[model samples]
Target: MSRRPVHSVRSVTAAAAALAAVGALTAAATPASAHAPVHPRAARHVLLLSVDGLHQADLAWYIARHPHSALARLAGGGVEYTHARTTNPSDSFPGMVGQLTGGDPGTTGVYYDDTYSSALLPAGTTKCAGVKPGAEVDLTEDLDKNQDSLDAGQGLSGLPGSILQMTGNPTTLLDPAKLPVDPKTCRPVYPHSYLRVNTVFEVARTAGLRTAWSDKHAAYDILNGPSGKGIQDLFTPEINSKAVGYAAGADWTKDNAGTEQYDGYKVRAVLNEIDGYDHSRTHKVGTPAVFGMNFQSVSTAQKLPASDGLTGGYQAKGVPGPLLAKNLDFVDQQVGALLTELRTRHLADSTTVILSAKHGQSPTDPTALNRIDDGPLLDGLNAAWKAAHPGAGDLVAHAVDDDAMLIWLTDRSQAAADFAKAYLLARSGTGNGIDGKARPFTASGLQTLYAGTAAARYFHARPGDDRVPDLVGVTQYGVVYTGGKGKIAEHGGAHADDLDVPLVVSGAAAPHGVRVDSPVRTTQIAPTILRLLGLDPRSLDAVRIEHTRTLPAR
Candidate 1:
């Protein structure tokens, strides 16, 4: 059952040199003496899994209650970081990228999937000759060729290959017409091009190691980094697509059960990869050196309301409701299956399993819920701006809001930003504006507002940076910018519940059942993976630029 290692010391050295020639690695990034392999036999393959929305508290609670669960087993036989944190504004796109690139939004140039870029032209704008460069860069299913189809409009002619099947490259699933165009080149920008930093997959593949991954959206093709060919076996099943064996309007994340079904698709893909096959189970490619997928069940369970009259989210801090508990068990069972396959294939001792979450849900305590409608809030601001300056049009270009509000203004002038901020602060109390209705914003929850240079600096960018927002509204912990009854909690904020996630590093070489209390970032996962694989961690561009280090040794 044993096989040769996918990458040898000599091959990695040659590959690193080749990568340096292509500028993926710089001579100064990695010292010459660091090329020597360390812990080569401890980890030949790394299996990384992101269980989205699993908070550190949730992990502790689950491990205490379900001691025999796979997650508990991994923690027992591994090093657990009790103070692990994801990136601020912890959305899936940047959160996952943080782990793969060893950089935050500032260095990665990826803030949110549906974020605004002031330096890009609108999609389908044929003439960028003299047009103003600004557009909403949608990297979600909206960019899919067929947003409603499971295969992203890759028409099916046969059975057993319609869903999660790629006829061509993953980028093909993204409709070019729907992508933002670079005003400089007048060409559509793909997901890979949108990323400013390289990923772990890029480094691994460049070092002659096989790489594969499965995720919820085709947009995750961004993980391919600048080269756009990092992952050899990339399977992206659109989670928002119409669910099979369910109603026509039902998508995977609509409910807990459907999300489990969606996660199961990726689980199967991982199992196939573990068995020395490609993600599709139709190709007999050798086991990948780096491969894994993300589970959406936990996230879905935390957001959607349960049918048994119990709302979603935690009953108390670090506690789970009935539905959430069920999904946790489901994720545990899936991990157990992966471990079983690894043992059966005799790759257990040689493989390192790194389990963590992309982000955590906020308002874990159901009593702290404060849902507000953001539409009226934005409309009021725009109306106030228009009233102040006649024929000025709308002041807001676009606004992405969850628990926090990121506003990109049509005019990035300081005067405009100051005016908006003043107007918002003046009307913080319950009052009617141009909307002629009671204001949704309360003085208590919507107190913190960053404008213009302040907002840019918050994201580590200079004033007027194309990607940085003009105004950022940070809500109180209990406040979620939504007027929906379906969801009780949400992510994408700087709160402890949103950024504090679980990080467990498990392998034969890792210390057993040791808990590290020091604060660690998800961005550390990239360089750590390279270290586990006996490669130069600094070879990754983001790691070099950010000076990211490997996980702390036990």
Candidate 2:
């Protein structure tokens, strides 16, 4: 990481106690928005946040219910885009990268937590890296499925370097043993490889801005590039590393915080990073270029697996249950703490705090919760195709099912493609059906869900890119295809419940209490961050491709 001299000139606004006392600021382009004020010096620091699974409706309900929360305070100082939405496959990986890089999964080459890659695993076989179609390098926290390879030589024993950074050198961050390698190609795929574009952090860093970010796992390591190294301080503690909270143990509450244990851990990590120190305060660094963290307690409570904390029923039917509500309150308190920290560090006016969700959970309505298994149907589809072709390989190479299903087909033949599309459409008919049986799959009635979506428009760079999902199926809202234990609500759909999320940008330059009804996508977030810092948003690959606009400021 590059470092400036300790005596480097600091932005007056960053050190100022209030915004009114601050002088005029300037940005890359003069404020071009027909609705924005005259040229103002750009915000100096950015505190981007990803409150995973926070629905637009949920935020409104939360504000309405808890009139005096920090969320309200932040919104009071900024404009919240009521119509902001995550990208198509509204799952965590794609969603986060969508905000960070302004690209859909197709552009990022990432679809879900566990996606199939055409790349083969490394030469030597490892239990974590399966030697097959290859899995997208995502951290689910569990050893088998997560970023165990980036475990700073500690594996699962202690915190992974991806989060804490035990080593001072940022270049050699990950341990080779922890890297995910392709079996056939014998190529080890580092986490950053997942993202196909440079993030705003990288763009900011290249322009001499210090960058930092934290999320649930090191898999977010994707935010690391546009360059070899950008983030000044990166923290990503595995949410699944601890089994006490959600595990059937003595009690998580007894250990201080229940259910919210993971979030609490990240809260501490984020605060530490914000203060320019590592977890242990071993070394001190500068303020930050673009720093942010994600909150998961609310999402965890809403989507708690059956075994986590569900004593009676779902977290809540129409409104949040006690547990979910408490978690929201906890996050709000955390937000307050974050704001206080910013002010304490004299960074209040200069730092833009972006609050939004990576994805939104489904089945917020109990009556809407419905879980279905597409495994049997998918297996049958494979069996039928296998029987017909004999040695043509399985029709379905890999499949990740959320509210939407990303299906990868092994048989790319025209006939097989036609059959698969027909099969999914047949199964996705009225009420989601196959033949005469009702197939509870996808919110969109047709399997051609991707056909008319931006996924097709943007994600499909060229014809038959192996990285592109061959077929996509969206289950009705509240419908899930997997029977994972303890799991309740799920996301990844085109429905409003999964797509619409909060996008609030608040700071000295922001118009207080204003709301932007202008339609915007989460993709605009990266560009907005750049614009906030007086950097050109079009400098980014995806932003240049998407023509993402910056948020309007008064």
Candidate 3:
């Protein structure tokens, strides 16, 4: 990640502390709006903005410090959910899936980035009829049938057992060999592959609403392999390989003219689409009714060198920092531009703007800040366990993200499962700087770990999923997962910081300056958007929480 470097540690820390203090004071003093007008007619256009890793608290802080921010301006004129929460294990994939599908892991079947594959292809089959490895299979019908069984823990071994029986095809599971390879390393890349479920774009398109999407990740655009029928146009910096004037082989950089700033490019694309519709460049009516985009530069900036100054350039600038702030500001400016266009074209009153995020980013623990390397903890554990067990099945330990480690035992035996758990517990605190070391668990241990918790409400296992991870390891707060450089920051855990995020609704068609304080989950986003658009949430099995009250029943 290319970012402006910060050179002063002492100054940076002091400045950040000061800024945080001031921000706290400002939040306490600021008065929230008491009431707002609500519009209820079906909206003509819906603009959805997704900012990666945006925290509601951070947003409030940004507004308090920089009242002129686009975010602040929008908030002042819109409704913000003060107490919003995301789904458990709030990782990017699940968060986004929740927004688009309005279903939690239980309903959507997207539990993690690397879930248990149920595909049963013939031996030696590398690809699925030319489809990329790790591609999503259509499991909607199967999921529906086995929902009850899965919830009952009939098949939780993370294998292709019962699910395969339901699907009737053993090779329909996820196969690593089918995952998209990195051009340089020949390894599977992020996102694994496109989703298998019907997303929001598809729903919108089916309703005759034109749509467009701009995201930083290629998988967002590369849905299930190529033909982007759900989305009319997809613009991503990572996949803008064929954009005119773009360097043929250069990597992502500022100099690459074709690679417009992620947010800026998306805003411009949205504005262009609106303009084209207004000028008759495209069909005036039945044109794109929804526009969605993502900005990732802020995440990139966090990984860059801190600037040399009090609070470091990154810390002093705010949560997103200067670079990201500038981009977000630009996004806001473009939002203003779109609003102006809507009003000028007499469309403002009919359009609804919904802003949200995929997940929130937790800052690196200052005490253990620059570590990004994962030691040979897994290897050592496996070596020791294997020496004792002799001919046990292969133990696969994968560091999924910064917070969780998944262990898969290839051989399905009671002895292997018992040994695996004991070994993990013994070596849990061996290498990681975490105070709470890894521990092995039996079926009973899971209950103890989540004693008297809401998490237990949603905990269910399927064949393949349950057996794959006989033992799971968790990192305590401030101890993020490391790949090599040491320990840095990451997500994919069951913590409030990782699961809580902001949900804001702003625009002429929405209720302005109203705040909703309730416990909400990502599964509600899809249904909420649908409801706002005058559609029925029950169509997708998304239950409307009691806290979701429409603006005056307009």
Candidate 4:
């Protein structure tokens, strides 16, 4: 939010015309690469994008069919990795952090967006002052001052049509009172402070390059990394807020059309950034050295159920249905718009465009869905623990359950975890096992369970680590721990379908039409971004801590 002023711009139209003229001059004066004369090998700029829930197979399927689409064009001029995997338990928080920090949950100490840390106090705990040092870290729309409004309580009521109309720093939109309190200092822990490592934005900023980013929630303030000054222009328009131009019942992720409108706001922001203006287009902040935004339309389409005769989710494995296909097309067009804008501004050749995903949706085949509510299961476990111990309150302090389950217990002892593990495994089988209802995992849904030391080791953390969960559950490929009827697919699992996402690196020093069949992780993106900008990858704290290498080149 701290920034310097730039030349005044009359209007959006004037800014576009001015940029076009400048582009004409730049094209005539210099080579395609903006800094070719000074730095021939390094790209002057890097455009990073994350298309959430875009699987590796989905990219291949789309490019194979739509040969002229934006994705296919990027693949044609880019190096596509066929087996690019995202972080395990692919929740958006750690998944995006992995790409921006060059580290996984193990090294970053970020397991999921909504997680528990025994070292932090509850939200609104003024002066922790003997208060318990344990609380759920919620990094979602719940942090918004008004989660129900697109403005996030930044302005008056009834203002609609676009989140861009909401002004001020994205971080300011989050009410500090809603954040978890740091017991040590009795201070609120903002999302940027919650991150344990530095990001590519921080590294680039340290190198005196301007940086920018756009994401769904203000909690993406995490992208700023530990320094809290990584991205100069951080644009976060709350996606979970009420949909613009729609009834109060409609939300962005609830419907495919609403999600498209939400994504369009970000696309416009990116276009504005491409035109050398801030995300809001009110000021000319100049183009950033590293900048991008994520697309949520595709992810929403892959999860939302059929409504108003519009169907979602995949028809079969690696095959998209009509609604999903339309959303994919919408994302493709947005990518094309960004690419076209880059070319129009004479920045394409000088820019390194990297397109990938934070996470992928599970059970691409809609019929594979198994909706089992983990809420009842947790309650049953608590009851079982109470019956066994006579009186222990509740064993679980918090449990974040999606397709996977990360459990934090009030009692972090190994014996307690063993008991919970046994209870869950026993109820995993068919028949009435818990709460006089059918077993939660009746269809062999639970594939793997890690508890106590096993859970600690899986995350490369010591037992009793404050941030590590006491138990981790990896469900079967088709299992999604949701009893809701609005969705057929979900993410945040260890399944191949959840972690295997697309990775495409295009333009400026990238090999064209080359497909790297080797396995790679999205964590490599941070180092690769720094490398593209001629910055040392080791400059990033996470890259150094994790020994992360730059993405492979053919």
User: After superposing candidate 3, which stretches have Cα over 4 Å from the reference?
Assistant: 1-41, 114-197, 221-229, 239-260, 276-287, 305-346, 368-372, 397-399, 412-421, 428-472, 541-554
> Which 10 successive residues of model 1 have the least lDDT summed?
18-27
RMSD of each: 7.8, 8.8, 14.5, 9.9
Model 1, 1-554: lDDT tens per residue? 01122322233234333212112222235562353443343578999999999998999999999998899999998878787888867899999999998988878888887899989999998888889888999989998887666666676544224454553256778888999999888999999999998888888887788999998778888999999999998888788887766667877787678788888878988998999998877888999989999999999889876733445667776689888988889999999999999999999988889999999888787666677777767788899989889988999998888877788999999888888787766654442222233444464256588899988778777677788888877777666776556677788887888888999888755767766665678888887787777777776777777787667633
lDDT tens readout by residue for model 2, 505-546? 888567677665545678778767766666666666776555
For each of the candidates, give the backbone clash count: 0, 25, 49, 0
Per-model lDDT? 0.79, 0.62, 0.46, 0.79
lDDT of 3: 0.46
List, residue by residue over 1-554, the lDDT tens digit for candidate 4.
01123222232233222212112011122221222222223688999999999998888888888999999999899778777889876999999999998888878889998999999999998966889788989999999888877666687555555456565357888888989999878999999999888788887776678888888888888998887888898887778887766656677787778788888888898899899998878889899999999999889888877643677788877789888888788888999999999999999998889999999998887656667877778999999999999867999999988888889999998999999998887775332211224543542257778899999988777677899999998887677776555567788888888888999889876767866665678998886776677656666667666677676654
Ranking by lDDT: 4, 1, 2, 3
Off by over 4 Å in 4: 1-41, 156-158, 428-440
Measured against the true structure, the TM-scores of the candidates, in listed sequence, are: 0.90, 0.80, 0.65, 0.90
lDDT string, candidate 3, 473-510, tens digits: 44454445564422234566554555567777676445
Error of 2 at 33 (Å): 24
| Candidate closer to the true structure by TM-score (higher is better), 2 or 3 | 2
Ranking by TM-score: 1, 4, 2, 3
